[model samples]
Target chain A: DQQVKQNSPSLSVQEGRISILNCDYTNSMFDYFLWYKKYPAEGPTFLISISSIKDKNEDGRFTVFLNKSAKHLSLHIVPSQPGDSAVYFCAASPSTLYNTDKLIFGTGTRLQVFP
Target chain B: DVKVTQSSRYLVKRTGEKVFLECVQDMDHENMFWYRQDPGLGLRLIYFSYDVKMKEKGDIPEGYSVSREKKERFSLILESASTNQTSMYLCASVRPDATGNYGYTFGSGTRLTVV
Candidate 1:
Protein backbone atom coordinates (compact mmCIF):
# COMPACT_ATOMS: atom_id res chain seq x y z
CA ASP A 1 0.00 0.00 0.00
CA GLN A 2 1.10 3.57 -0.63
CA GLN A 3 1.75 5.43 2.56
CA VAL A 4 1.84 8.83 0.87
CA LYS A 5 -0.41 10.07 -1.93
CA GLN A 6 -0.64 13.07 -4.24
CA ASN A 7 -4.00 13.00 -5.89
CA SER A 8 -3.27 15.72 -8.44
CA PRO A 9 -1.13 14.69 -11.37
CA SER A 10 -0.78 18.16 -12.89
CA LEU A 11 -1.56 21.78 -12.16
CA SER A 12 -1.27 24.91 -14.31
CA VAL A 13 -1.16 28.44 -12.97
CA GLN A 14 -0.43 31.87 -14.38
CA GLU A 15 2.75 33.54 -13.31
CA GLY A 16 2.65 35.55 -10.10
CA ARG A 17 -0.35 33.61 -8.85
CA ILE A 18 -0.52 31.47 -5.78
CA SER A 19 0.04 27.80 -6.55
CA ILE A 20 -1.03 25.29 -3.97
CA LEU A 21 -0.19 21.56 -4.21
CA ASN A 22 -1.76 19.11 -1.81
CA CYS A 23 -0.72 15.74 -0.47
CA ASP A 24 -2.24 13.07 1.79
CA TYR A 25 -0.66 10.25 3.73
CA THR A 26 -2.14 7.19 5.40
CA ASN A 27 0.46 6.43 8.05
CA SER A 28 -0.08 8.40 11.20
CA MET A 29 3.34 7.32 12.41
CA PHE A 30 4.94 9.76 9.97
CA ASP A 31 6.23 12.76 11.86
CA TYR A 32 8.41 14.48 9.26
CA PHE A 33 7.26 15.66 5.86
CA LEU A 34 9.30 17.11 2.99
CA TRP A 35 8.85 18.66 -0.43
CA TYR A 36 11.23 18.25 -3.34
CA LYS A 37 11.20 19.79 -6.82
CA LYS A 38 12.53 17.87 -9.80
CA TYR A 39 13.22 19.06 -13.32
CA PRO A 40 13.36 16.75 -16.28
CA ALA A 41 16.65 14.79 -16.50
CA GLU A 42 17.65 15.88 -13.01
CA GLY A 43 17.25 14.48 -9.56
CA PRO A 44 15.04 16.12 -6.98
CA THR A 45 16.16 19.05 -4.87
CA PHE A 46 14.82 19.80 -1.42
CA LEU A 47 12.39 22.71 -1.24
CA ILE A 48 10.83 22.78 2.20
CA SER A 49 9.87 20.60 5.12
CA ILE A 50 7.58 20.61 8.16
CA SER A 51 7.53 18.68 11.38
CA SER A 52 4.46 17.20 13.02
CA ILE A 53 4.97 19.38 16.05
CA LYS A 54 4.25 22.49 14.00
CA ASP A 55 1.34 23.30 11.74
CA LYS A 56 3.28 25.40 9.27
CA ASN A 57 6.71 26.35 7.97
CA GLU A 58 7.71 29.05 5.54
CA ASP A 59 10.71 30.09 3.52
CA GLY A 60 10.46 33.29 1.55
CA ARG A 61 8.00 32.66 -1.29
CA PHE A 62 7.32 29.05 -0.31
CA THR A 63 5.24 27.87 2.65
CA VAL A 64 4.22 24.42 3.80
CA PHE A 65 1.17 23.75 5.93
CA LEU A 66 0.55 20.53 7.77
CA ASN A 67 -2.81 19.43 9.12
CA LYS A 68 -1.94 16.59 11.43
CA SER A 69 -5.55 15.85 12.27
CA ALA A 70 -6.43 15.37 8.62
CA LYS A 71 -3.29 13.51 7.57
CA HIS A 72 -2.84 16.14 4.89
CA LEU A 73 -0.24 18.72 3.87
CA SER A 74 -0.05 21.44 1.26
CA LEU A 75 2.71 23.47 -0.35
CA HIS A 76 1.98 27.04 -1.34
CA ILE A 77 4.19 29.07 -3.63
CA VAL A 78 3.39 32.72 -3.66
CA PRO A 79 3.89 34.59 -6.93
CA SER A 80 4.81 31.40 -8.64
CA GLN A 81 7.25 31.97 -11.46
CA PRO A 82 8.10 30.17 -14.64
CA GLY A 83 11.22 28.85 -13.05
CA ASP A 84 9.12 27.11 -10.44
CA SER A 85 7.59 24.85 -13.02
CA ALA A 86 8.59 21.30 -12.14
CA VAL A 87 7.38 18.08 -10.63
CA TYR A 88 6.84 18.45 -6.91
CA PHE A 89 6.91 15.42 -4.68
CA CYS A 90 5.76 15.15 -1.10
CA ALA A 91 7.53 12.70 1.14
CA ALA A 92 6.93 11.43 4.64
CA SER A 93 8.98 9.51 7.12
CA PRO A 94 8.94 8.54 10.72
CA SER A 95 11.66 9.63 13.10
CA THR A 96 15.08 8.63 11.85
CA LEU A 97 15.58 6.61 14.96
CA TYR A 98 12.83 4.26 13.87
CA ASN A 99 13.18 4.00 10.10
CA THR A 100 16.77 5.14 9.72
CA ASP A 101 15.56 8.11 7.66
CA LYS A 102 13.94 6.17 4.86
CA LEU A 103 11.53 8.47 3.02
CA ILE A 104 8.24 7.30 1.56
CA PHE A 105 7.17 9.54 -1.30
CA GLY A 106 3.87 10.40 -2.97
CA THR A 107 3.40 9.89 -6.68
CA GLY A 108 4.11 13.59 -7.39
CA THR A 109 2.28 16.62 -8.81
CA ARG A 110 3.52 18.42 -11.89
CA LEU A 111 3.26 22.18 -11.49
CA GLN A 112 3.39 24.43 -14.52
CA VAL A 113 3.80 28.16 -14.11
CA PHE A 114 3.10 29.91 -17.38
CA PRO A 115 3.31 33.52 -18.31
CA ASP B 1 28.58 21.58 -0.63
CA VAL B 2 27.94 17.87 -0.89
CA LYS B 3 27.59 16.44 -4.37
CA VAL B 4 26.41 13.08 -5.65
CA THR B 5 27.53 11.99 -9.08
CA GLN B 6 25.93 9.40 -11.32
CA SER B 7 28.26 7.81 -13.78
CA SER B 8 26.02 7.88 -16.80
CA ARG B 9 23.34 10.28 -17.94
CA TYR B 10 21.67 7.76 -20.23
CA LEU B 11 22.05 4.12 -21.18
CA VAL B 12 20.27 1.69 -23.47
CA LYS B 13 20.63 -2.03 -22.96
CA ARG B 14 19.06 -5.07 -24.52
CA THR B 15 16.97 -7.51 -22.53
CA GLY B 16 18.81 -10.19 -20.52
CA GLU B 17 21.96 -8.06 -20.28
CA LYS B 18 23.65 -7.37 -16.99
CA VAL B 19 23.57 -3.67 -16.02
CA PHE B 20 25.43 -1.61 -13.52
CA LEU B 21 24.61 1.89 -12.29
CA GLU B 22 27.25 3.66 -10.29
CA CYS B 23 26.92 6.43 -7.69
CA VAL B 24 29.60 8.39 -5.95
CA GLN B 25 29.43 11.04 -3.27
CA ASP B 26 32.02 13.71 -2.52
CA MET B 27 31.09 14.05 1.14
CA ASP B 28 31.70 12.19 4.33
CA HIS B 29 28.15 10.95 4.71
CA GLU B 30 28.13 7.25 5.48
CA ASN B 31 24.59 6.67 4.24
CA MET B 32 23.91 6.23 0.52
CA PHE B 33 20.70 5.30 -1.29
CA TRP B 34 19.41 4.20 -4.71
CA TYR B 35 15.95 5.15 -5.94
CA ARG B 36 14.06 4.85 -9.20
CA GLN B 37 11.65 7.52 -10.45
CA ASP B 38 8.81 6.58 -12.74
CA PRO B 39 5.95 8.55 -14.22
CA GLY B 40 3.03 8.80 -11.79
CA LEU B 41 4.91 6.62 -9.29
CA GLY B 42 7.25 9.22 -7.81
CA LEU B 43 10.53 7.94 -6.44
CA ARG B 44 10.83 4.47 -4.96
CA LEU B 45 13.81 3.27 -3.00
CA ILE B 46 15.58 0.13 -4.17
CA TYR B 47 18.54 -0.21 -1.83
CA PHE B 48 20.52 1.64 0.77
CA SER B 49 23.83 1.27 2.55
CA TYR B 50 24.52 2.74 5.92
CA ASP B 51 28.22 1.94 5.80
CA VAL B 52 30.76 0.03 3.84
CA LYS B 53 29.76 -3.62 3.50
CA MET B 54 26.38 -2.88 5.13
CA LYS B 55 23.26 -2.71 3.00
CA GLU B 56 19.48 -2.77 3.37
CA LYS B 57 16.61 -3.32 1.00
CA GLY B 58 14.12 -0.59 0.36
CA ASP B 59 10.55 -0.54 -0.91
CA ILE B 60 11.38 -2.23 -4.22
CA PRO B 61 14.24 -4.71 -4.18
CA GLU B 62 13.15 -7.30 -6.69
CA GLY B 63 15.48 -7.87 -9.69
CA TYR B 64 17.97 -5.39 -8.24
CA SER B 65 21.04 -5.75 -6.06
CA VAL B 66 23.55 -3.31 -4.57
CA SER B 67 27.17 -3.30 -3.49
CA ARG B 68 29.00 -0.93 -1.15
CA GLU B 69 32.61 -1.90 -1.12
CA LYS B 70 33.83 1.64 -0.46
CA LYS B 71 32.58 4.52 1.63
CA GLU B 72 32.16 7.01 -1.22
CA ARG B 73 30.65 4.68 -3.79
CA PHE B 74 27.48 2.61 -4.16
CA SER B 75 26.69 0.38 -7.08
CA LEU B 76 23.34 -0.95 -8.29
CA ILE B 77 23.41 -4.15 -10.28
CA LEU B 78 20.72 -5.71 -12.40
CA GLU B 79 21.40 -9.42 -12.65
CA SER B 80 19.50 -9.53 -15.90
CA ALA B 81 17.97 -6.42 -17.36
CA SER B 82 14.31 -6.40 -18.30
CA THR B 83 12.17 -3.83 -20.03
CA ASN B 84 10.18 -3.51 -16.83
CA GLN B 85 13.31 -2.25 -15.12
CA THR B 86 13.69 0.71 -17.43
CA SER B 87 13.40 3.93 -15.49
CA MET B 88 15.31 6.97 -14.26
CA TYR B 89 17.68 5.89 -11.50
CA LEU B 90 18.82 8.37 -8.85
CA CYS B 91 21.39 8.17 -6.11
CA ALA B 92 21.40 10.14 -2.91
CA SER B 93 23.34 10.70 0.28
CA VAL B 94 21.50 11.44 3.50
CA ARG B 95 22.17 13.65 6.48
CA PRO B 96 19.96 12.85 9.47
CA ASP B 97 18.64 15.38 11.88
CA ALA B 98 16.23 15.40 14.82
CA THR B 99 14.38 18.71 14.31
CA GLY B 100 13.18 17.90 10.80
CA ASN B 101 16.32 18.99 8.99
CA TYR B 102 16.88 15.71 7.23
CA GLY B 103 19.03 16.60 4.23
CA TYR B 104 19.09 14.26 1.24
CA THR B 105 21.35 15.32 -1.61
CA PHE B 106 20.65 13.61 -4.93
CA GLY B 107 22.65 13.03 -8.09
CA SER B 108 21.56 13.98 -11.59
CA GLY B 109 19.63 10.80 -12.43
CA THR B 110 20.63 8.20 -15.00
CA ARG B 111 17.89 7.26 -17.45
CA LEU B 112 18.04 3.59 -18.46
CA THR B 113 16.08 2.15 -21.37
CA VAL B 114 15.98 -1.63 -21.78
CA VAL B 115 14.59 -3.13 -24.90
Candidate 2:
Protein backbone atom coordinates (compact mmCIF):
# COMPACT_ATOMS: atom_id res chain seq x y z
CA ASP A 1 0.00 0.00 0.00
CA GLN A 2 1.14 3.54 -0.70
CA GLN A 3 1.33 5.31 2.59
CA VAL A 4 2.19 8.60 1.01
CA LYS A 5 0.44 9.94 -2.09
CA GLN A 6 0.88 13.00 -4.27
CA ASN A 7 -2.34 13.20 -6.23
CA SER A 8 -1.05 15.72 -8.78
CA PRO A 9 1.37 14.30 -11.26
CA SER A 10 2.50 17.73 -12.49
CA LEU A 11 1.98 21.44 -12.01
CA SER A 12 2.70 24.48 -14.16
CA VAL A 13 3.00 28.00 -12.96
CA GLN A 14 4.34 31.35 -14.12
CA GLU A 15 7.46 32.86 -12.68
CA GLY A 16 6.99 35.15 -9.70
CA ARG A 17 3.79 33.33 -8.80
CA ILE A 18 3.02 30.94 -5.99
CA SER A 19 3.19 27.23 -6.76
CA ILE A 20 1.52 24.80 -4.44
CA LEU A 21 2.05 21.01 -4.44
CA ASN A 22 -0.08 18.78 -2.31
CA CYS A 23 0.53 15.35 -0.69
CA ASP A 24 -1.51 12.98 1.42
CA TYR A 25 -0.72 9.99 3.59
CA THR A 26 -2.64 7.03 4.95
CA ASN A 27 -0.27 6.10 7.77
CA SER A 28 -0.81 7.74 11.08
CA MET A 29 2.42 6.51 12.58
CA PHE A 30 4.37 9.05 10.56
CA ASP A 31 5.68 11.78 12.78
CA TYR A 32 7.90 13.80 10.43
CA PHE A 33 7.66 15.00 6.84
CA LEU A 34 10.16 16.38 4.30
CA TRP A 35 10.23 17.75 0.76
CA TYR A 36 13.00 17.24 -1.76
CA LYS A 37 13.65 18.86 -5.14
CA LYS A 38 15.30 16.88 -7.92
CA TYR A 39 16.53 17.98 -11.31
CA PRO A 40 17.17 15.79 -14.31
CA ALA A 41 20.20 13.53 -13.85
CA GLU A 42 20.83 15.03 -10.39
CA GLY A 43 20.25 13.77 -6.91
CA PRO A 44 17.41 15.10 -4.84
CA THR A 45 18.29 17.88 -2.44
CA PHE A 46 16.50 18.71 0.77
CA LEU A 47 14.15 21.66 0.51
CA ILE A 48 12.34 21.98 3.84
CA SER A 49 10.72 19.87 6.55
CA ILE A 50 8.02 20.04 9.19
CA SER A 51 7.71 18.10 12.39
CA SER A 52 4.40 16.74 13.55
CA ILE A 53 4.52 19.14 16.45
CA LYS A 54 4.29 22.16 14.18
CA ASP A 55 1.82 23.01 11.47
CA LYS A 56 4.31 24.91 9.31
CA ASN A 57 7.98 25.53 8.60
CA GLU A 58 9.47 28.14 6.30
CA ASP A 59 12.80 28.46 4.62
CA GLY A 60 13.18 31.62 2.58
CA ARG A 61 11.13 31.12 -0.62
CA PHE A 62 10.14 27.58 0.31
CA THR A 63 7.59 26.77 2.95
CA VAL A 64 6.09 23.46 4.12
CA PHE A 65 2.77 23.10 5.84
CA LEU A 66 1.60 20.00 7.71
CA ASN A 67 -1.85 19.00 8.90
CA LYS A 68 -1.62 15.97 11.13
CA SER A 69 -5.31 15.47 11.56
CA ALA A 70 -5.79 15.18 7.85
CA LYS A 71 -2.56 13.31 7.08
CA HIS A 72 -1.78 15.92 4.49
CA LEU A 73 1.06 18.34 3.77
CA SER A 74 2.00 20.86 1.13
CA LEU A 75 5.01 22.71 -0.20
CA HIS A 76 4.56 26.30 -1.30
CA ILE A 77 7.08 28.26 -3.31
CA VAL A 78 6.61 31.98 -3.45
CA PRO A 79 7.60 33.82 -6.63
CA SER A 80 8.57 30.59 -8.32
CA GLN A 81 11.55 30.87 -10.60
CA PRO A 82 12.59 29.00 -13.71
CA GLY A 83 15.42 27.44 -11.75
CA ASP A 84 12.86 25.93 -9.39
CA SER A 85 11.40 23.67 -12.04
CA ALA A 86 12.04 20.10 -10.98
CA VAL A 87 10.42 16.94 -9.59
CA TYR A 88 9.27 17.47 -6.03
CA PHE A 89 8.93 14.49 -3.72
CA CYS A 90 7.30 14.40 -0.33
CA ALA A 91 8.51 11.80 2.18
CA ALA A 92 7.38 10.75 5.61
CA SER A 93 9.20 9.05 8.48
CA PRO A 94 7.36 7.12 11.11
CA SER A 95 8.51 6.30 14.59
CA THR A 96 9.36 2.64 14.67
CA LEU A 97 10.63 0.25 17.32
CA TYR A 98 13.69 -0.78 15.31
CA ASN A 99 14.88 2.82 14.97
CA THR A 100 15.34 2.36 11.27
CA ASP A 101 13.80 5.76 10.48
CA LYS A 102 12.82 4.56 7.02
CA LEU A 103 10.99 6.99 4.78
CA ILE A 104 7.83 6.34 2.78
CA PHE A 105 7.75 8.40 -0.40
CA GLY A 106 5.05 9.78 -2.66
CA THR A 107 4.91 9.33 -6.43
CA GLY A 108 6.19 12.92 -6.91
CA THR A 109 4.94 16.00 -8.69
CA ARG A 110 6.83 17.72 -11.49
CA LEU A 111 6.74 21.49 -11.12
CA GLN A 112 7.34 23.58 -14.20
CA VAL A 113 7.94 27.28 -13.73
CA PHE A 114 7.76 29.36 -16.87
CA PRO A 115 9.10 32.84 -17.17
CA ASP B 1 28.92 18.71 3.15
CA VAL B 2 28.04 15.05 2.73
CA LYS B 3 28.90 13.54 -0.63
CA VAL B 4 27.03 10.45 -1.77
CA THR B 5 28.44 9.06 -4.99
CA GLN B 6 27.01 6.36 -7.22
CA SER B 7 29.70 4.51 -9.17
CA SER B 8 27.90 4.60 -12.48
CA ARG B 9 25.67 7.21 -14.11
CA TYR B 10 24.21 4.59 -16.43
CA LEU B 11 24.60 0.86 -17.07
CA VAL B 12 23.24 -1.76 -19.42
CA LYS B 13 23.29 -5.44 -18.69
CA ARG B 14 21.96 -8.56 -20.36
CA THR B 15 19.24 -10.69 -18.90
CA GLY B 16 20.37 -13.43 -16.49
CA GLU B 17 23.50 -11.41 -15.69
CA LYS B 18 24.37 -10.20 -12.25
CA VAL B 19 24.47 -6.45 -11.65
CA PHE B 20 25.96 -4.38 -8.92
CA LEU B 21 25.37 -0.71 -8.16
CA GLU B 22 27.77 0.96 -5.78
CA CYS B 23 27.20 3.87 -3.46
CA VAL B 24 29.76 5.57 -1.22
CA GLN B 25 29.17 8.31 1.30
CA ASP B 26 32.00 10.47 2.63
CA MET B 27 30.53 11.53 5.96
CA ASP B 28 30.58 8.10 7.61
CA HIS B 29 26.87 8.22 8.24
CA GLU B 30 25.47 5.04 9.74
CA ASN B 31 22.29 5.01 7.71
CA MET B 32 22.36 4.09 3.99
CA PHE B 33 19.51 3.27 1.64
CA TRP B 34 18.72 2.04 -1.88
CA TYR B 35 15.61 3.12 -3.74
CA ARG B 36 14.28 2.53 -7.24
CA GLN B 37 12.43 5.34 -9.03
CA ASP B 38 9.89 4.54 -11.69
CA PRO B 39 7.65 6.70 -13.86
CA GLY B 40 4.50 6.50 -11.74
CA LEU B 41 5.80 4.51 -8.75
CA GLY B 42 7.99 7.20 -7.21
CA LEU B 43 10.80 5.93 -5.01
CA ARG B 44 10.49 2.48 -3.48
CA LEU B 45 12.95 1.32 -0.89
CA ILE B 46 14.75 -1.89 -1.81
CA TYR B 47 17.16 -2.16 1.07
CA PHE B 48 18.86 -0.19 3.80
CA SER B 49 21.80 -0.58 6.14
CA TYR B 50 22.15 1.00 9.52
CA ASP B 51 25.76 0.03 10.21
CA VAL B 52 28.72 -1.83 8.86
CA LYS B 53 28.00 -5.46 7.94
CA MET B 54 24.28 -5.07 8.57
CA LYS B 55 21.32 -4.77 6.24
CA GLU B 56 17.57 -4.99 6.16
CA LYS B 57 14.98 -5.54 3.45
CA GLY B 58 12.64 -2.75 2.62
CA ASP B 59 9.27 -2.69 0.91
CA ILE B 60 10.44 -4.11 -2.43
CA PRO B 61 13.41 -6.37 -1.85
CA GLU B 62 12.16 -9.31 -3.88
CA GLY B 63 14.68 -9.25 -6.74
CA TYR B 64 17.42 -7.27 -5.00
CA SER B 65 20.04 -7.67 -2.30
CA VAL B 66 22.46 -5.29 -0.62
CA SER B 67 25.87 -5.16 1.02
CA ARG B 68 27.35 -2.84 3.60
CA GLU B 69 30.76 -4.23 4.41
CA LYS B 70 31.97 -0.78 5.40
CA LYS B 71 30.24 2.17 6.92
CA GLU B 72 31.04 4.43 3.98
CA ARG B 73 29.90 2.11 1.20
CA PHE B 74 26.60 0.42 0.40
CA SER B 75 26.02 -1.70 -2.67
CA LEU B 76 22.87 -2.99 -4.32
CA ILE B 77 23.09 -6.25 -6.16
CA LEU B 78 20.69 -7.76 -8.60
CA GLU B 79 21.07 -11.54 -8.66
CA SER B 80 19.51 -11.87 -12.09
CA ALA B 81 18.85 -8.97 -14.38
CA SER B 82 15.37 -8.69 -15.84
CA THR B 83 13.62 -6.11 -17.94
CA ASN B 84 11.34 -5.32 -15.01
CA GLN B 85 14.36 -4.29 -12.99
CA THR B 86 15.39 -1.59 -15.43
CA SER B 87 14.91 1.70 -13.68
CA MET B 88 16.70 4.55 -11.94
CA TYR B 89 18.38 3.48 -8.73
CA LEU B 90 19.17 6.01 -6.03
CA CYS B 91 21.36 5.79 -2.95
CA ALA B 92 21.11 7.92 0.10
CA SER B 93 22.86 8.47 3.43
CA VAL B 94 21.48 10.14 6.50
CA ARG B 95 22.78 11.30 9.84
CA PRO B 96 20.21 10.62 12.49
CA ASP B 97 18.86 13.79 14.01
CA ALA B 98 16.09 14.74 16.37
CA THR B 99 14.12 16.32 13.56
CA GLY B 100 13.89 12.97 11.67
CA ASN B 101 14.91 13.25 8.02
CA TYR B 102 15.60 9.93 6.30
CA GLY B 103 15.61 11.47 2.84
CA TYR B 104 18.72 13.58 3.17
CA THR B 105 21.91 13.42 1.07
CA PHE B 106 20.98 11.45 -2.05
CA GLY B 107 23.31 10.57 -4.87
CA SER B 108 22.82 11.57 -8.51
CA GLY B 109 21.40 8.06 -9.19
CA THR B 110 22.24 5.22 -11.53
CA ARG B 111 20.01 4.48 -14.50
CA LEU B 112 20.16 0.78 -15.20
CA THR B 113 18.82 -1.00 -18.21
CA VAL B 114 18.42 -4.72 -18.74
CA VAL B 115 18.12 -6.27 -22.15
Instruction: List fnat, each candidate.
Output: 0.52, 0.50
- Write the residue-wise lDDT of candidate 1 on A35-79 in tens digits: 999999999999998889999999999999999999999999998
Give the per-residue lDDT digits (tens) of candidate 2, residues B1-115: 8999999999999999999999999997889999999988999999998899999999999989999888999999999999999999999998776544545699999999999
What is the TM-score of each predicted model, taking all chains together?
Answer: 0.96, 0.95
Error of 1 at B62 (Å): 0.8
lDDT of candidate 1 over B7-94, digit per residue (tens): 9999999999999999999987788999999998999999999989999999999999999999999999999999999999999997
Q: What is the lDDT of residue A20 in candidate 1?
A: 99
Model 1: lDDT to the true structure: 0.92
Candidate 2 matches the true fold with a TM-score of: 0.95
Top candidate on TM-score is: 1
Query: Where does the lowest 10-residue lDDT sum fall in candidate 2 chain A?
Result: A93-102
* lDDT of candidate 2 at residue B27, scale 0 to 100: 91
The lDDT per prediction is 0.92, 0.91
Fill in the DockQ of model 2.
0.53
